[model samples]
Target chain A: MLRKLTVLAAAVGLAFVATSALAASTKEEPVAPSAPWSFDGPFGTYDQAQLQRGYKVYREVCSSCHSMNLLAFRNLGDKGGPFWDPKYKSSVENGYVKAIAKDYQIADIDRDTGDAIKRPGTPADHFVAPFANEAAARASNGGALPPDMSLLARAREGGPDYIYSIVTGYHPAPAGLTVPAGKFYNPYMQGDLSSFWKGDPNKVPVGGFIAMPPPLADGKVSFDDKSPSDLKAEARDVSAFLMWAADPKMEERKQTGLAVMIFLLVFSGILYASYRTLWRNIDHH
Target chain B: MTAHTTYEPKTAIERWLDTRLPIVRLGAEVLEFPTPKNLNYWWTFGGILSFCLATQIVTGIVLAMHYQAGGASAFLSVEQGIMRDVNYGWLIRGIHANGASMFFIAVYIHMFRGMYYGSYKAPRELLWLLGCVIYLLMMATAFMGYVLPWGQMSFWGAKVITNLLGAFPIIGKPITTLLWGGFAVDDPTLNRFFSLHYLLPFLIAAVVALHIWALHVPGNNNPTGVEVKSKADTVPFHPYYTVKDGFAIGVFLILFAVFIFYEPDALGHADNFIAANPLVTPAHIVPEWYFLPFYAILRAIPDKLSGVIAMFGAIAMLFALPWLNTSKVKSMRYRPTSKVYFLVFVVVCLILGWCGAQLPDDAVIPALGKTGINLIDSDLNSYVWLSRIATAYYFAYFLLITPILGLRETPLPVPDSISKPVLAGEAAKKD
Candidate 1:
């Protein structure tokens, strides 16, 4: 009798849960269309060429607004990265990453004066910020702060998909909508509360108006390795690059994970055998 | 020195050590302690939880070696320094992060098993109470650890939870300020949370030791809810339970590894990846998944003070469970009605978790085919009403239904001896 009552009560509770879930699902937000990623599934590894192209796209366009502060110049030449080469070192004498690092000027402290100074970047130096400070960044971009790109791929909801959509999703304002002077309409940018002027619904983008003017265009960036320079290709490349930036050790991690799994499988099998042997003579209730 | 059967030293050196400390004898006795022969797979959770704690502590200590506790550097230290710079840092951090969820998973199963078997009944009441203490400590430790990442959700979650102290009438504001270490959650707050997060786990370890000691005093409770009457009804803890627990641990570790390796962030909110900014708050500020049921209870009430009280009450009610349950019967399996009520309560808890995930006051009924109806404004979108109902039932299940059912319900006939089932099973095996 109690079992029946419990089942009935459970059924009622489950009904409410289902109902609430259904209601919540009705308030739909646009989701990024899935794109094929090289580093998606269990056996997936990063595409060396794709990562290289993505880095190129990031260097030419995205670097102007974004700061990859957490990424060191040495990481670019590390294993699993697009530019990774076992023989390559970030020394000025060595290879391309070293050359790339030297191209930027990083801020350093003056040893004698104990004051900030700028010098050519080194292998250990993090990517230099385009702006001196947040104030400078906002001043240059009409008060909109471009977030650091180091972990951007992991930070957002849809991640690489979201980044790809926003880069290519920019379009003219809708027929009835009037975009404000500083803002540009992008269907993919999910605006925070301050994204638009307060109480001005017409000025708000369908999703959220972003301050960034469309940053990508066909053939805007020239790739030396001869990958496609179309807007979509460029977008894909940059998104892939950001994903690598977010999780550079993914390839190594997955490989180690496989080994761990195999060890656990064999170890557990042995343990189970031992357990059965121990229990063979004893009858459990 | 102990009641349980123990090893006798056969050599002069062994006898010398045994007389001095007797630690080896203590280990032998514990391993040989008689356990109920009727224990099922549910009994394996205790071993799994212990393994989880050890895993967390090991990985956590290594991660802390690279972790920076200050607000400014904490986020970057985790995402960049530990994950990127350290050798196999990602693996260590992933294991630690996912290990927390796994720990909760094992502990929840252990708790539910205890509940189902009426493990809290007298003589074992102190054991159950000690388990509760460990549980509360786990919650506090997990909460502080979550804040250590200093991500968007971490910052806001800390802010929201600490601010709840202000709901107290006279001492609330002062307590909140002291907890925050200033006007709001800042550097000092982060520093203290890290210090306390590090300290509480050791405290939990101590309490866990007591919990085990308390359990040994009375021995483990079994599914039959009957006391061991004869030697035939019990088996040595070693060889029987130790081997079984080892196999279970291996299986549990595989499951834990899947999360660590494959879906490391599947259990976490994405917003947590973003560094915390005082100026910006995420659209929704939610706690870790384990806290959702209590979080739901907190939000169920409209008033701040009442909501806080209700959430604490939910946990406090668990401590009162042993005394509140007046039934002569211990196991719900014997009392069919009690079993039904238990199932309902589990479902109710799950619903509360679901409610916690949703925006409060959101409509439960979908607005499909409704023309020009203002549903968000109406009570439809809100789960406020439903949550209140569920919360009321939660209290009623323990306070009213448990006592009433204990007095009125008749239980199924229990076996007189554990050996009967074993003997019957052996006879069947011959066929």
Candidate 2:
């Protein structure tokens, strides 16, 4: 069996080398290394404090342009989420979700008057869009549409790492390279043709350019608990928060995984015992 | 089938039922069927596969309850409604998505076990063929399921694969059009895919019944590749194999749950979270991992028509397997050279899968650095050529190696009975 495994490994290794040799010549988008995530491994859980800080970063910075349209204000109070309130049940009457919702104004029509009206947000309302419509968003952002932040972490290749890299990867174009107007050099963003800002032979990042400028800066948003207020720290926090937003059921899932695995293992042990006893004396042909 | 005590209806109700339909008798026969005592853990995969099928069906029916199949709403429905709003919807959707992968994983193990043990040979030919039919349906069901998500990969993968049918001579164009339900993959295509996806699993279930019936006709072939000659060589399926299969399923479910809960999206492509946009295509549009081996075979050939033929032919080749290998020995374990070849075949298939996942234009491995010696074009990478070689080996393993190895290589000494090794304590050594 060992010999068989060795032979199989050698065959696969040879094939991998032969094929990868060819794949080396073609230039593809560079995949950024994933930063260590709090919820990465089986036993991992989100640091609630960090998630809250990250949510702050998103609210103050990212929400200006990007929309988290799929998220309800009520989602903030769910367990495993950043703003979960233990005291709050399903109803959000006086909970933190209600408080958070009050920070933004939501647009709705007045049922009695039959006219458009602006009102304070509640837990039921989705995150308010910065712009009224797609056309307005495009007009404001130099024709590039800002993607929704709700599933941004999952939608991108490297998840949280990709978001962090893009947010912090901005650099000046190298010598002999021209910066196209309205585009900034960021190696990680998947933008249009001009976004491929590999202008500087010396400084061009793997991916070309990005339309969204550096959205994070040092000390941009002060943390209540006084975690690091640097650009990298902010990027990491927001990315983590986005990841939680993308899959809020992660904590429940990991807990369920632990219980299920333990149950199965015990069940298997019982079955094995029964198997041994059943076959103990049946040894003839 | 191995001889067993015929079912005797003890109770009045059982007797009446037995006289009317014999359903109870059939159930009793299945439960008490004589299975070879020497059958190993590999045999447990059939039960595991059945559990996966039932899981997929149950979870799929629930997912469909909330799943919106229309083009405009399908993507949002999955990402928002199914994943977010519905109670425990995330868990159900996660299980369904990952369950497809689990199902394929079990099926592959089952098929390979059959191959290694020569379970496809002789009287089990129809059984093996029925398995192939089930596999074909599974691929179709999985493909259609992937498309219903309406993501970038979903749209592009559906388009790329559906267009492959156009490579056919005269009937290809119409078939492709009919499949799409229009000039392009639109709302109509999504609806039809949803309908067929719901329908094919039941067909697979029906065929699985036939597969089992065929297996019962000849009973099971033991790992020793020898037929059972007496009652001592066999055991009742109820208490022994049942407990064993149940334990194996527990193990399988544990692994499945790890993926379902901890890393549900790990097996999935991240790009799938993005809604389907016909205007934008991903840099590399690849099928799900299970389809990669066949996908590699498809791309191994450059011509569209030939690639299409080769892809389908790869699956069709399995149906001819019982006749292709002329070996009299039933198990690869007894055929030393054939065992080595079998290992090589498994490796080649894995490499083919890895190749399929890679971008065709990218280099798989870098050219030997600064050798100043170039084999072909300095610009051309080795990935395509390696894929071709692996693809050739995949076919040759079935077409040439099996028959030739049977005639050429000497096999190990054969045990006359399944109980011989166990009685002599050699079975423990094998384990």
Segments of candidate 2 deviating more than 4 angstroms: A1-35, A190-205, B1-3, B367-381, B421-431
lDDT of each: 0.82, 0.82
- Candidate 2 lDDT score at position A56: 96
lDDT at B9 for candidate 2? 93
lDDT of 2 by residue, A19-136 (tens): 3433432244555555678887888899899899999999999999999988998888888788786776673553788888988888889999989998999989898889988789
Interface RMSD (Å), each candidate?
7.6, 6.7
TM for candidate 1 is: 0.91
Give the residue spans of candidate 1 off by over 4 A. A1-28, A89-94, A110-116, A192-206, B367-381, B421-431
Compose the digit string of candidate 1's lDDT tens values, residues B1-431.
Answer: 24778588888988999889877788888899999987877788898888888888888899889999998899989998899989999999999988887788778778877888899998799999999999999999999999999999899999999999899899999998888889999999999998898889899989988998898888888987877788887899998898888877877787777767876766777788889999998888878777878888998887899999999999998899999888887888678999999889887887777777777756666563223444433363456656777898899998999889989999887656666643445447532
CAPRI class of candidate 1: acceptable
Please list the Cα RMSD from the true structure of every candidate, rounded to 1 decimal place. 4.7, 4.1
Chain A vs. true chain A, TM-score per candidate?
0.82, 0.82
